[model samples]
Target: MTFKHSIKTALGGLHSNTSRSILTILGIVIGITAIMLVLSLGAGAQNLILSQIQGMGSKTIVTVPGRQPSGPSDFANVFLDSLKERDLQSIRNKANVPFAEDVMPVVFGSVRLSYQNETYQSTVLGGGSAESNNVMSDIFDIYPEQGSFFTASDVLSKASVAVIGDKIREKLFGDIDPIGKKVRVKDKTFQVIGVLGRKGQVSFFNFDDMILVPYTTAGQYLLGRKYFDRIIVSAVSEETIRTTVNDIEMTLRANHGITDPEKDDFFVETQADLADRLKTITTALTLFLSGVAGISLFVGGVGIMNIMLVSVTERTREIGLRKAVGATNSDILTQFLFEAVLLTSLGGLIGITLGSSLSFIISFIISKFALASWSFSFPYLGAGLGLLVSAFVGLVFGLYPARKASQKAPIDALRYE
Candidate 1:
């Protein structure tokens, strides 16, 4: 038979069992959709994280205190112990530290802030110096909209001043200017020295939603804790970044005591390092999701086989009549097997279209709100490849039933109910 004739005959056979064909296709559709959605989400999240890291400034370095081990599974509780007041002074004074510009220890945690009748929960960051402006600019890249960042004098005097994130500004002050207005952190009141420029969400972290205050004030008044959770340092120039990071690591390792790498208390990472790691993690997650989604294709193929078997039984008399009319055994087998492959291939096409559409919708949402570059909708090659596999599966599993139909005795089949 010509290819066109084979396709026409296969399609007619499919239509004869519309409800069964529809049910079988549903399985493939679900499997493909799950695979597409998971891969898109993983890719979107990876892009979001990298963009946030890059925005922190290309050459910047961030050192966070690793979790102090209390025991296994309590790993999340570990954070850098306070860099002692004297140690912080020493770091600030290190002259050979390339660029030797600014070193600020930041204390951050969840807290409540209140202004007049308005109250809100917010993340509070307490650390500021003239050098802090450079570090913050490079990392968060947010500048003051009004007033100014806290001064060196402010850090020295432990001034009661704060730089508010845009979210807190909107919540507390609304249309009114927030600079110079007093807001309470925990219980003590501090004047808002500046309002930070609007920065949209980055890497799942929202810069527009935090509050910055003098580290000394935070140590003395709000938390009454001497230790800092994290420390941020800024270099004078791009050329000084690598040397500065090396010097800072050596200084910290010495201060922490042991020379062994395993005993080291802190982790020093650059933005580029972080982006690479995130990419690897997202790739793994995407593959895992795709594997899980492929399960539905197997189930769909099985449904096709079962339905084909039933079709063969129902058309026994027809098979016999065809044989009597000079149709060869191969022709009878080809007709039934062709029906199965056509059903699966059509389902595969529909699945590919729907799955791609869902991925694009999710990608659109991620780009719009997450400040990441938008990605164009692309066909999932895996899904298309999976369709071909599904067709093969139908061809293989449908053969046995088709051959059994071809073997039926003409007289016996014609006499059956």
Candidate 2:
């Protein structure tokens, strides 16, 4: 029989047992759907994280306290109080780090901010120097929409002045002007000097929800800590990033009195290194989830094999009739094989539609209610892979049943009930 004739016959057979065919490929549909959804969500999350990281610009470098974490158990390194005022001074000195264009020492803590009858709990960021405004403006492109950032005198004198984010301004002052108004931070009243423009989440950190103050004020009166949590450095140019990072490492090592690089109490990371690390982490997580979803496909393949075996047994007389005429064994085999492939291929199509729809809905919900940065993405590769895997599954599982049906003797099959 011709290939087209076999396909027609196989489809007719499937149509005749519509309910059974649907049941047989149910697992395949579910498996494909899972694979597509997992891939879509993974891609969306990776894009959100990477976009935030990229917003910091390519020439930026971050220096964090504590030894670099080598394993999960070393996560405590993040909380270590290793960076101090002297360390910040060393990094800011042009003689020590000539390539460094800007530096900002940062320390943050949760605080209760209150104005009049309003009270809200929010994170307060302490910036070490007045140049922090320049760093934020130049590298992050963040500037105050109202008033301006605090001056160098404010930081040096540990002045109780604050720059509030858009969200904070809305919650505390509402329509009233917040500039020159006083807001209490940890029992000390600070004059609101500026209001920052809306800057959304960056690398999972919500800048819009936090208040900015001088690191001196925060360390002295708010957080009651002398050490900085992190130090941000911007290179003069992209080419100077490596040199700046090296200078920072050298400066910190000298201050901490560390002779060996392995024993250094701090870690410095460039923007490129951070981006690569995030990509690797997200890719590994996506693959692991995909592998888990593949189990359903394996189960579906087994189901296809079992159903095909049963189909062959039930159609023994029909096979005998076809062979009794001029139909060859190859013709009978191809017909059965096509039936199996058709079922799985149909399942794959259905799964692609369902998975894509579900992914869209999930993405929409997340973006609307959670992070606005969350986005919906089409899983084109996942859809293509699902279809290919479905076809391959049918081919592998249907072979035995098709061979069995083709091998049945005409006399024996004709005599069977």
Candidate 3:
């Protein structure tokens, strides 16, 4: 028989066993669906993370007061008391860090904010100098919508002035003009000077839920710590990021009297470094989950093989009649192989469609409810790979059944009950 006729015979055979064929492909459909979902979500997560990290500009560097975290369990080391005022000052010195364009010491704490009877728990960020106000404004890409930022005098005098987020304004002030109002923080009351515009999240920090104050005041009064939690530095240009990092590290090491790099207490992370680390983590997680989902495909392949074997046995009398009527063994093998491949390939296509539709729906829900930045990405590569894998599985598993069906003697197959 011709190849076309072989394929036609294969379709007729599958159509006769429609229920069994559908059941056989179910595992393949599920496996491909899971893989597609993982790949699509993984791509979206990576994009969001990289975008957030790079949004701050490639020239940005963060100096934290602890050894570099190697894993999740070492996160507590990030809060270690290492970066002090002297380290901040040294980083700011032009001679010590020539490439450093801007440097600010950041100290933050969660505190209770009160305006008369209304009270809310909010995070307070402290940092900014006469020179650093515009610097922060540039770095965070935020400006006050209603009022103005505090003056240089505020940082120097440790003044009780506060700049609240837009959300804070809505909750506490309710349409009332927040500027020039007094908000209490513990025993200290700060006069509201400015309200940041509706900037939701900047470089992983949510500006909409935070309050900004002077670092000196926060260090002495709010957090009651003299050391800075983090020191932010920006380079003059993207090309100078490495130079600035090296300079900041050398300056801090000198201030701390450390000669060995491995023994250093603090860690410095540039924008590129952070992005690479996060990308690696995301990619690794994606691969791990994808591997787990792959187990289902193996099970699906086994199901297909078993079903095909059973199909050969059930069609034994037909196979004998065909072989007796001019059908060659090669033709019989091609027909059975085609049946297996068509079943798996059809399953792959259905799986791709279902997986993509589900992925899009999930992405929409996540973007609407959880993270506004989350987005959907079609996994074209994954779809292609899934299809290829499915075809390969069919080819490999179908070979044994096809060979068994082809090797049957015409008289013996006819005699089988």
- Model 3 local distance difference test score: 0.88
Backbone Cα, N, C clashes tallied per candidate: 2, 0, 0
> Lowest-scoring 10 consecutive residues by lDDT in candidate 3?
129-138
Q: What is the C-alpha RMSD of each candidate to the true structure, in Å?
A: 3.6, 1.8, 2.0
In model 2, the worst 10-residue window by lDDT is 128-137
Off by over 4 Å in 2: 76-79, 128-133
lDDT tens digits, residues 287-317, model 2? 8998898899889989999988998999999
What is the Cα-based TM-score of model 3? 0.94
Compared with the true structure, what per-residue lDDT tens digits does model 1 show for residues 361-405? 778776677644656445466666767866886788778887887
Query: What TM-score, to 2 decimals, does candidate 2 have?
Result: 0.95
Residues 31-110 of candidate 3 have per-residue lDDT tens digits of: 99999999999999998888878777788899888888787877765547898887877888899999888888889989
What is the TM-score ranking, best to worst? 2, 3, 1
Which residue pairs come into collision in candidate 2? none
